[model samples]
Every structure is written in structure tokens, then in C-alpha cells.
Target chain A: MKYKDFNHWELAEDAYFVNWVLRPNKHADKFWKQFLADHPEKSEDVLLAREIVTNIRYSDKPRLNDTEYNDLFERIISTKRSKRPSNVFYVREAQYRWVRYVAAVTLVLASAILYNQYWLSSHPSDEKTIQTLVKESPRGSKLTAVLSDGSKVKLNAGSKITYPKEFSDTLRLIYLTGEAFFEVESDPARPFRVKSDKVNAEVLGTSFNVRAYPDDRKISVAVAEGKVKVTNADQSTVRFEHTLLPFQESEINVQSNQVVKRELQDDMIFAWTNWKLVFKEEPLSLILKKLERWYGVEFELKGAIKTSETYSGSFDNDPLKVVLEVLTSQDAFDYEIQGRKILITSKY
Target chain B: MKVFSESSITSNGELKKTTSSRKLSHQEIVQGLEQGDESVLGYIYHRYVQDMFGFGSQFTRDRELVKDSIHEVFASLIARRQSLEKIRSIKSYLFAAVYHRIIYDIKKNTTFKNKNQKNNYREFNIEFSVQNRLIMEESNREKLNKIKSAIKNIGARQRQAILHYYYDGFVHEEIAMIMGLKNAHSVTKLISRGLKAIRESIAVVVVLFMTDLG
Candidate 1:
């Protein structure tokens, strides 16, 4: 029967009406409201039908209890865990293949230089002392290093850390570029200082992340676990500095020397440490830059992007192509990838 | 092969590949699983195991068997992720995979004692429950039971379409994919027909009640 011919009881039995009551969305709400307004007499029928649809109970469908679900989930995870060793082996194999090639070349050169210095009767006493060690993470990878004072530093992609082999009695200092998370060993007598190009972060016994990429317009410091003192390192007329507490972040604009401080959510600031990327309403320009550094690829923008265009999203260990696909899906853009470079253009 | 070799080039080349592995989407998780990433396998399990188990239970009363089928489907997905084609909807793909596994298990065990089980497996059914607080009158309760039975009397395909669409909250396209229909049009037809039958049955019950009351 046509919907117009149906009485209140028959309207109540209509599946579309019942489904609308079960799960109402914007469109459904509009349609039902319009229907009620068009046929005021059917209002009681619509209400009764909704009641009937919501009241029908199906007792025959099989159900899995919560305990069963949890048990099954654990079993599946355990099965994957049992197979993890082989996966780890493959990762190690892939890592070592490159490490071995680099190590071999460096080892041969080092041995030749050492032999020349010792056996050629050179005055070794005049040689410069190698009192500092420099550790760098390439464009797409992160690197962790242990300082002589037992503190650990995690360097983000395309970053570097230079530290002394031995700490001085007065202070423990490390030079940083790009970004790094520092877990300083507690020694109240000696302050730990990280000197980046644009900013210097000092702490007594705390952990924090400092991001000071040279080309970026701003430098930011986020405190994760402890307090930190951040000061402008640039030799400019006006300097910006701030003392950041736990879950606090400070950003210093390089061009204007304006400092902005605010409370930060742990996930937003420290997701990178767990290998996740979280961007909240960040400009497309900044997102692309971060993606370029994280993926080790060059992004050439071929079209104009509005300055106000921003994207907020998070990803946890996805390939570059997939991440690019998701980003472009939202905006009107097309991208082409060639070897190590990606060209993004307007989708017109 | 070229990708692997490129990853071993220099620190610069390594950095590029390393960054690519930082964040994962659903598609990436599938790709990672294929590449023998145990973490991705764990991720897929945690994300969809409950939904899969609920859907699988419809085919059989054996909860353990349903659980086993879910486990087997995921294990096989991990084992075959490398060769598995790109899936458009992870949810529908998983539902279809688990559905096939349960059907196969049922067919395999169709012995003399399992003959009744075969009949039960052939028909798709869902349990519906009304909120206890909403049932205020005896006649309303009677009307609800009539509608529930009417839903059962509809064709199996119609019942499956309604259950998948309404109860499971799957879109028409996803329901079509899961139910092996030609397209979403078929699913829409099945659901409408099922609802029509229920309406007819409820109308008859309503007339009988009114006449008896008079």
C-alpha cells in the first residue's frame, strides 16, 4: 500500500518510520518532521509506530559475553605475539644491512689513519683532543643517545645533538639542532642545558622536548614530565623566554620574537615519542613540512593554497603514500610521487 | 626489491624510508600486516574482533567455534596480507571473511548429528529486545511480540538485510557487500519487502484485537 493510504496503525508498521525512530540522523529528523507537519493527523501514528519498533525484542540472535570477547581478543594478540620474533628478525636484518655497509667503509678509513699516526713516527701529542661526540638522526629516522651523565636524548628526524664526552663540574650541557626529547638525570648541583640555534632550554632534573628547526618560523619547547626554563638564544634586540611546567608548551616566533605559552595535552605534545603524528588545526604549509621531514621526501607545491587552510589529523605508523592520500582527500589537491619527491598541484 | 635497496643507501635515504613508517592508517595497517608487522596484526585484532565475533555468532550457537573462526580469519589475514588485495572497507571485508569461514566450518561438520545445525545455519536471525521501561501497557506488549514474529516470518534474505542494516548499522553498500548482493539496490528492496510483511501482519493483529475488545 502507498504511504498516503496507510492509517496511523499501518504507518506505525512502516519500516522506514521504524528505522527512523531507531536511528535518527539529520536527514531522517528533517524528513519525519516534515512528514508530521504535512499530515498532522499522522503524528499519533508515527509516535505509536516508533514505540512498536523500539519495543520489538529479538531473543534468538546469539551473543558473545564480554569475558568471551576479551578472551578471544587476547588469544588473537598472543598468536600475533608468538610470530613477532620473525618480524623483529626481518627489521633487524633490514637495519643491519645498511649499518654493515656504512660500518665497513668507516672502519677501513679509521684503521688506515690510526696506522699512519702510530707507525709513521708522527708527533701524536700535538693532535687535537676529541672531547665531543656528535649524534645525528637523518631526515626520516629518529635516533636515541645516552649521555655520559646517564641521561638519554631522543632526536627527531633530521636533528642532531652534540655533547661532551665528560660533563664539567659546573654544569652538564648539550648542543641541539632540530628537535630532541631529553630525560636528564637528576643532579641538582649541575643544571642540564640544551642549546639550540634559536633557544636554550635549561632544567635541573626533568624531561622535555625542544624543536628548533632552523628553517621553521618558530621554535617550540614542550615539557612532558618536569619543569624547564627556555630562553631565546638568538642575538636579537628583543628576546623571549618562559619557565614551562609539566604539560606546558612555549613557542617563540623567530621573526617577531613573540613568545606564546599555554597548557598542552600530553598526547598532542608527546605523541611523536611513541611514533605517532598528531596535528591539530595546523596550517597545510606546516603539515607538509613535518611530513617532508618525517618521510624524507621533498614536497613541491605547484598550486596556491589559502593561508587559512589547515588540517587536523593523527596517524600512527602509516606509509607516506597513504598519509598523502588521506590529506589530499580532504583538500582539492592532486599529488604525484617520483622516487624521493612528491609534486602537489590543484585538482582542477 | 628496489625499495629495500634504496632504504640501505645512505643515512639520508634511510631517513626517508624511516619517516614513511611513522604513522599508519587503515590501509597502511593492512599493508604493514602484509609486510609482517606484528604490531599491525595486533591492531587489526583489537579494532574489529568484537564486531566479527558478534556477526559470526549469528550463523552458529557455538560461541567457541565462532571465536575460532574469528581467530582463524585474522591469522589468515596476517599470513596472507602481502598477497591480499586492497580492501575498500575493512569492516565489510572482515565481516565477509568471517562469514565465509563460519559457513565453511558448518559445511565441514554436516554429519548425521549436525543435520539440525545445518538448518539453523542456513537461516539468518537477530535478537530484538524492547526497553523494559518503555512497555507500559499489556496491548503494547502484545503488539511488540506480533511485530517480532512477523520479522521472523519474512524471507531469510530480507531478514538478513534488515538485521545487517538496522542492528549492525552498516550502510546499504556495506550490507550489499557483506550479504553478497549484486548492489545496494537489492538490499533496499529486501528491507522494504520485509517491513511491508511485518506491517501487514501487525495490521491483521490490530484488527483482531479491536474486534475482540468490541
Candidate 2:
């Protein structure tokens, strides 16, 4: 009979037969062993299913580990840096505000040209460009630059940059990973785009910095001037953009695609540019994310304690001991920071 | 299956010793794990890791993934060990948990579950090993290929249920839970129907084989 002729009961019966004979549990093995004795003709089918199931069970593709895990941890934990600080061009909105607008306009034009030449070569005129960027920087190396039109960017170590060579007239686009400080140029006719691995940050004429790493689910953008929009790529049809008024910071969680915007010390947004740890009621995950970047080590958390409890405090280049002490000070928590891994628990 | 073959399982003789030194009972093991006792965790790993790893090998021959999945199972057990009362049997619990985790990880990385059934079957086509390879005296390789093709013609869901439950010895409830069934009854029905289909199809081919022999 055709499979379609089988009623739900019949279908379920065949399903069970295939599953039972193919994957043989104690129950199925006993049942089928008895079954073949009564209906000897059914033996071939049972054997076929068993062989097929055996084959399928053994067929699986392998998963590879992230080779850069140690390097990522090192960058998060260590503070030692190069003495030859090559004129690090840190761009704030105040110093070169006009450069932001120029960059924004150029981003728009570059995107338009790239879209026409690549994406819209055969399509009708109403074409939109979907730009993607994937950039990664090595450890101890930081990238500082002003785009052709004037948007300033300061890239942190172990970061990635992928974007269209230029922005389309309608939309300006760029992509980032790791961390970067952005001074976006403003243009009402176009919206500048910085699509991180998990998020898309957009703005007109504003000065902000975004720290978004692919491996880490948290994407942080702090606005120092004008307004900004940070959208979750995993969610939203038209991009979730946060209009960042000055002195405000927003973190977008990639896993849940949840956004949290908070007001903080405006100076802290630019503080990391000068080597600092700024914590304002941050979760252990956020602190650990930053700590792992500053120190090259891994953290292994075990036990019954929930790691989401918020810790409120700030430190500027303080000793690593103080950081661990502050984390362990909570009555509900205790921690041990070993050479390369920190183990946090509720036993304290 | 590859990892926990009879050879490796038998080779780890010390692991099989029925020591009378008041070894930790299941409850004690759960308690120690909940209390964050590394010794208890290590004991469980030593006792169960090979079996689980071997069982996982049947699912995929990727050694690293099997190792990764085995570690995840232990880690999850530690995290949930506090509520051990809910687990009826640690044996079934660990097996089902590892199976689900492996499937989820595979689905996420490959995104192959939703594609056409033919591609799915192709992805799972088994390559015979050098030493253990079946050598049919009279039947040629083409006949073996036909048998494989016939097996692939089965439904994907039926095939998965059969493979996980029959080959790995996973119970109906466990299979139901992993396959996202509502209850054991559903799994029972699914296995039954899948088997009947295979049985009927294979019977026809067997008859044809007899006729050809005559």
C-alpha cells in the first residue's frame, strides 16, 4: 500500500516499526525478536531498517573550536601597550564636527555607486543595497582613521571591518566587529550605517563609539554628540535604531536581541580610548567581557549562583585585585581569579 | 557507537570494577555534584563519559564534537544536579540530554533539517570502514548501493526516530522528548508505523530475490 493509504494509526505503526527495528531499544529489541518469530517474512524489513538507522547514526559533520579564544581573553585582561603611540587620532564631535557630515555624505555616495555597479546592474531602478562588513584586527593593534568623506573611526585590537567601498545616495553603510569609536557625519537625506556582526548602528551627524564583537553577544554604543540608532539584526524588519542623545549608552544583546539604554558619565564613553574600566551597575557578564579584553585569560563559572545580578561601581586603571574584590564583595557571591581563568561561585 | 565499541568499553577494565569501597550511590553522587564536589564530578565523568562518548559516536563520527557534547552533558548535569529528585534514572537522563544537545548543535550549525529529504539522506550516507567493511561474497557493490538507496527512500522523521531509538536503545519516552512528541504513546505509534512500512517494502524485495534465485 502507498504511504497515503496508511491511516494515522497505520502511519504511526509503520513509524514505530521503522524506529523500533532501526534503533532497537530493550523494549523494541524484545518486541521485534518475538515479532520475527511469529511473522518470519517481516525479518528482511527489520534488518533493512536497522542497517539504515545504523548508517544515519554514524553520519555527522564535525564542529571546529574557535582558535582565537585565548588571544581574545588576553586582550580583555591585559593593559600593557606599545610605547610608540602613533598620533592616535581620537575624534570627538567637538574637535571636528564638520568631518562627521562630510563622512556621512561620502558614505551615502559610495553606497549608491557600489549598489548600482554590483547589486542593481540588472534590476529595475527601485533597488536597495544590503551591505555586509566582516573585519578582524590582531592583538595589540588598534586602528584609527577618518573615512574619505570625514567620519572618524578608532578600531580596537582583534576587530573586523566589512562595508561597501562607498555608500549609496540613499543609504550609507559599514560593518564592524570587536570595538570602534565612530564620529558619524550627519545628512538628513541619508542615514549612515555601521552594521556590526549582530547589530546595525545608524545616525545622521553624531559622535559615538560602538563595541560589538561577534563571539560576544553584547553590542555597546555610547553617544557623545547628536543622536544615533542601534538596531538588532536578528530582530526587526526595518532595523531597531536608538536615537542616542549625548551622554547616553545603549547595549544590544545579540542572543536575546534585547536593548538597554542608560545615562552614564559622558566622559566614560571616551574613557576607554585612554585605557579605563568604567562600570555603572553593569552585570558580571559585561564586566567579564571587558575584563577578558584587558587581560588575556579565560573564565569558567560554575555552581548555583545566577550571574545576572548587577554590580554598581567604576574604576580607572585600578589593580586587577580590586576588580575581583569588588565582584566578590557581594554577600551572595565569591570568586577566585587564577592565572588564566576566574571561577565565580556562591560559596563565599 | 564507534567510540564505545566493545573493544574500548572492555579495555577500560578499571572502570568496570565493582569496587566494594562504599562507592557513592546515585543519591550521593547527585548530592556531591550539587555540593560542587570535584571528586564526585570526576567520578561521574570517569564512569559515564566513555559510554556517553561511545553512544554519541554512533550519532556522528566527529570525535571532537562527541567530546564537546560529552563535556556539555556533564556541565549541564552539574548545573541541574541540585534538583536531582526529578531525575528517575541518571542513565536515561544523561543519554537523552546528550542526544538532544547534539541534535540541537548539529541543526544550528548545519541548518539541514528543513531542506529536501533527498539532501538529508545524502548527508547521512554511510561510508564503510576499511577493516570492518562488509564483504558480500556473491553480491556486488552495486547491490549494496541499491540497498542503501532503498533505505534512503524512507521518510526523514521516520528514519530519525528509528535511528535514535532503535540503534541507540533510547526509550519511547526519551525518544518522544527528543523528537518533540507530546508523550510516549506518540513515539510508540511513530516507530510502529515506520517499521511496518519498511517491513512491507522489504518483504516485496525479498520475494523478488527468491524468484530470481529460483
Candidate with the greatest TM-score versus the true structure:
1
lDDT, candidate 2, at B56: 60
Every model's TM-score: 0.41, 0.34
The model with the greatest DockQ is 1
Interface RMSD of each: 15.9, 19.8
lDDT of 2 at A327: 62
Q: Kindly list the per-residue Cα lDDT of model 2 for residues A1-348, writing each as its tens digit.
A: 253233323433455665665455898778757866876665554554344445444334333222112211121112111111223233221222232221110010101112223334322343554343344555445667665445557666555555554556776666555667665554556666766434556766544566655566455666654556655543342245566655566765544546677875535445555444566666767667667766545677777775566655555445666767766664466778787777777783
lDDT minimum window of 10 residues, candidate 1 chain A: A102-111
lDDT of 2 at A143: 65
Q: What TM-score does structure 1 among the candidates reach?
A: 0.41
